[model samples]
Target: MRLKLLAAIGLAATLYSCDDTTTGIGDFVADTDEITASAQTFEATTKTLKYTDLNPNGVFSRTSNAYLGKFTDPDFGTYTTDFITQINCTEDFEFPETMQDIVSTTLELSYSSFFGDSLAPMRVRVDMLNREIDDDGEDLGLYYTSYNPEDFYNKNEEALAEQDYAVRDNSWTKEEIDSIKKANGYYPPLVIDLDKARKAKGEETFSAFLKRKYNEDKKNFKDSYSFIHNVLPGFYVHNTSGEGSILYIGAIWLRMKVSYLIESSSGKVDSLVYTSIPFAATNEVYMSTRLSNSGDNLEKLAAETHNTYLKTPAGLCTEVKLPLKEMYEALGNDTLNSVSMAFTKYKNISENSANNPYKMGTPKNLLLIRKSEVNDFFEQKQNYDSKTSFLGTYSSTTNSYSFSQVNRLISQIFSDMRTKEEPAEGWDEYNTLVLIPVKTETDSQGNTIGLSHDLEVNSAKLVGGEDGEKIKMEVIYTKPKFNK
Candidate 1:
């Protein structure tokens, strides 16, 4: 699944409040029969959003007025922004570059399929933010974090050695430094798993354990975000509702403005500066194509068994992804040249590595768990496994070529068009721009008798201009919101 994240304030609430809070606001004066008559209008409004009604917990309603609701002070409550986006196409082929311009045109058309045929509506949600302030007043963003606080503490022991290294001021002997380096893996853990420890002492919830643990190791809890030099943690959204769900849930992370007070003695945050972790909502459209029955089977398998891709063909199975180069050869036209030109330029600009980020395995017993836990489990397990898809190999490296690298090469066509000039030919006349090879088993007789089979490539069209002259491309680019 392609994941894009965006943040938004409550727009629906604004629309709703405007209707109910006016000076003349009052229950509508209607006859009981008139109210009953309004049901048709209510149902009509909801039918427009038939898909959203899928959530059993949700409600659909209609109202005549829109109103604004009281908001928590931005100073105290939360403030957020939703990223507004549009599909962009910039062509970069100029004069002689027009030879490669076909690639750019092809890319522009293909790009739509990469994300979707249409745009998704925006969405907003409230998330808890964590912040720290020093005694003198300074904001420190998150410096440390852990899936489990206990895991943080375990890691913290290693960080102490690094601190010791700094305190030694290079006075320590090489032998001493080596010993510490061996003992300490890296920095200290930012989140401590107090709950686990407290449980040993008869404590219950992990939240309660944190209070107990923090009090004992208060000295270690100083403003850590300041020392947080390399790593940052960001949230991986499992799923979201409202507009984000219009095209699957847009996954997101936070970028916050924090305030803190530095302690006079320890140089750590002494008072709360106001812990606000605000997210900069951004989104990218997901692009993928389903292969008729096989594709449907793949999706169902994932949903039913909590699996991803095709581990085993469940029901109907059909075509598989054809090779790009082979297909290019089959077309026996300028398609390869166009694709190559785009691929080369895309590499120059995007510097994309041939990695499949979406490849993942079905959880051991995912279907048995509650829906809410599915996201959390995947979040935890994602770090442990290598992603691979039966549709394609895990490594971009194939028996001879890197398909993803080639795709990246193809992506360049679209990228170039976005930044460069559009070709004079335009896209209306190009018809099909991309060609891929699909192989099938063949029964043949070698020496006119012995049996043997050979594979062959075929041409496939990806993009076109008004009359199908221009070509377009598409890609799924994942950018981390904060960090992890």
Candidate 2:
């Protein structure tokens, strides 16, 4: 089936020609009218902006060494794997009253409002507008290198190996001294003492001349002691234009553009800048119904995306990994603290434990339930107990959800997993799988290990024993049917 597009427009053009009867002076010349220069219709249009993978092979560096750099805005943010379908174009294409706001804020901000077609805007506009960088990597090296007397001593040893090439204490040549004086708009207070230079040049001592310059004539030295030699990387982006669409007859044209600043230290995208504009047109124009319908569609699509992502093995793996990294960071450098945190983070069970599938209660423990199973659970509850069946409403124990709530969540997930090739699934019912780490501890070398300790209920038996004991559950109510 062909997917419906959000924007559709048509353009027209015409051409003309004229002929002359020049047989004689009496011959009459004929003139004709013609049309020219019209816009054409496009079946579809799509564009995407992507960052060239800095690590071209998509692999991290092999060197074990690490570096510390200043953090930039939008440098280390989380990527919600869940699909998030949203309406990008809500305002009519009327020229914005405050043009300055366009420059200060993200022009293509995502927002929901009462407007045309009830169609939810595809958040692709936003993701397409921005870039993602995983700055979550923790560098343990930064800790010891900065302080730790032992590390400092070891670094000194490394430096001593190339002592001959190290900075000289007083070995400033006349030319070098002159260059520095000219750079700072002054002559060196005194010429480099030749005897002092010979004695301290290989001794790894700071230059006495440099010290005097810093302590006495600090202002003059500031210009001479610059860090221009520092090696750094950066990413640069330049936006060219915006995407526009005509909503209604004589309606305004909504336009949006994508741009972002770059991180100079690591040469990565720092933040995204979106620019949008609305053209003005006079007409009895209203887009509430259209916006509402779009919103509804987006809600549906988001829900579909959420389930498909969480239920997948890769999604489950990512769900498991994110928390582990966070927990490790929280533990800090203390061995005991790290060990305790590790155990707390990873809890498991024994093979012979009574529980079957294993019960996980952590927020990171993602529960992916089949849509059918969830509906069945609700239907069963409604039959035996007469209570509010709204999916959003929850009981004191089990978190109750409304269809809309679940759909929205799922739809957001779908937006994250945007791909035309991926098949969409229906929410007939829903169920979930929980991940629990039972056994965890640190070894002598400070490495943490985890082991599964127990088992819990399985699919066939919603709640049962480790040996696959089934719950004596029953469903009295059934889904309603509509027919002619």
Candidate 3:
């Protein structure tokens, strides 16, 4: 009896020390006693059932990739995507002193990643845009998965730079690479050498045109808006011929290297200078997809079972339908703590065969969120959280994605119940959720800024239903007050 009293006193003191602001021991002890009593009464048990449901007609976002390519994904179907970007600099461009000769002009693109096949060959054709884009990148304007690229470009000026490319960009001579790195301070995998001579149509070449701009359209180099509108329109990069690969372009630099004879403070001297314009002033990615085989899998996915799939590039998502009505009845008027679940991926033999030659496997991460919010979430690149969403990655050792935020989600449901809002039995706004595979984007500080649902590049099959042992939720709670 003496030892038990000492233990209680020690626990009370620890709690007080942790809080440091408590004014009375009576209230603290009473709250602690209530927690202890509730814990003793309510035992946690894992419930296996459908809590979130993925409905038909999931949401899709606009274009997401930089190098827009035309590829036929066996599962997700055919897609045509292109990037329209305006180039700018934090400072004004410095043109060469004298416009004497056109030495060389080049546009280089460097990327760290690519999607689809590297073994297959593809070609990217670049052209100047005829249409004008907004200078303010505050918003890239409305983009959808069904927009067309032909509507933007005029197809004028023979190809600026055409390169036969693959996933790994290693087609550069060591000397050329060293020169590029020295000029730009970075090595670009893809290089487009602008021709110095005019085209068959007698139009000015890229270098000659820039030289003309140096003398005539000097106003264009003053600011980004003038550069994009008055002098140069955005460029359109697309795949002329390719069906099995997608390239992710990170940075683009349009530079003009020139040499001129100038009479300076000394004598007449040969001078060399370069002007760099990056395509960041404003940009938009337009994506158009032609889904051909996704319906074949959806027909099989109709039946809710232990087997469900999540395909990407906005293809298909797994739906979960939790029994919110039953949960409310079982734990009426309780202080909820948390809720968690584990989702597992199963084996699919056709994952790498001729049928799925792409060898597309499960996505690195999955998102859990309200069904209706799918549109705004992807359009804005929102994150997974306890209130409205959750994200989990695949664990190879366990072959599963675990989500443990039931209490936080359920508590929001309970909080909504206070408003007397018309409920769907137990939930106020949402009772169904779908698992979406997304391309997450982060800020410079390493915080997630948004998510892109525009690329159709990922797919996965998940094990669910009553047969899977891991497909269950464990919700913790403290019982309510009793009227004696």
Name the lDDT value of residue 176 in candidate 2.
83
* CA-lDDT, candidates in order: 0.20, 0.20, 0.56
- As a whole number from 0 to 100, the lDDT of residue 346 in candidate 1 is 16
TM-scores, all candidates, are 0.17, 0.17, 0.73
Per-residue alpha-carbon lDDT of candidate 2 for residues 1-484, written as tens digits (9 for 90 to 100): 1122223221111111100110111122322122111211111111110101111111111111111111111111111111111112223222222222222111111111111122212111111112121122343222111122222122222121111111111466768855764775433321112123323455422223223333443343222112001100101111112111101111122222223354456776554444543322111111110000112322232233112111111111111111212222322111110010010111222232224222322222222222223223322322111111111121224322112112222222333333322334422111121221122234788543322111111111011222222212110111112222
Among these predictions, the greatest lDDT belongs to 3
Ranking by TM-score: 3, 1, 2
RMSD of each: 31.3, 32.0, 7.3
TM for candidate 3 is 0.73
Displacement of residue 59 (Cα, Å) in model 3 is 6.5
| Best candidate according to TM-score | 3
**Model 1 lDDT at residue 282:** 26
Whose TM-score is higher: candidate 1's or candidate 3's?
A: 3
Residue-level lDDT of model 3, residues 1-484, one tens digit each, is 0112236455445433332221210111234354421111222221122112331233344433354455565444565555655566334665555656665666666754556676567787777777766634354233444345566676665666676766545666668767776886555557667563345447677777766775785676777666767666766667778667666666666766556566666675754444443334223322223222344444444444556667655456676666565565565456554456777776662443346656665688777777678766765656665457887768899888877655566666655654654585545255666666766677899776666553545566666643433345655444423333
Regions of model 3 farther than 4 Å from truth: 1-31, 34-67, 70-75, 135-141, 155-163, 168-188, 194-201, 262-266, 270-306, 349-358, 380-385, 418-429, 440-451, 454-456, 465-470, 480-484
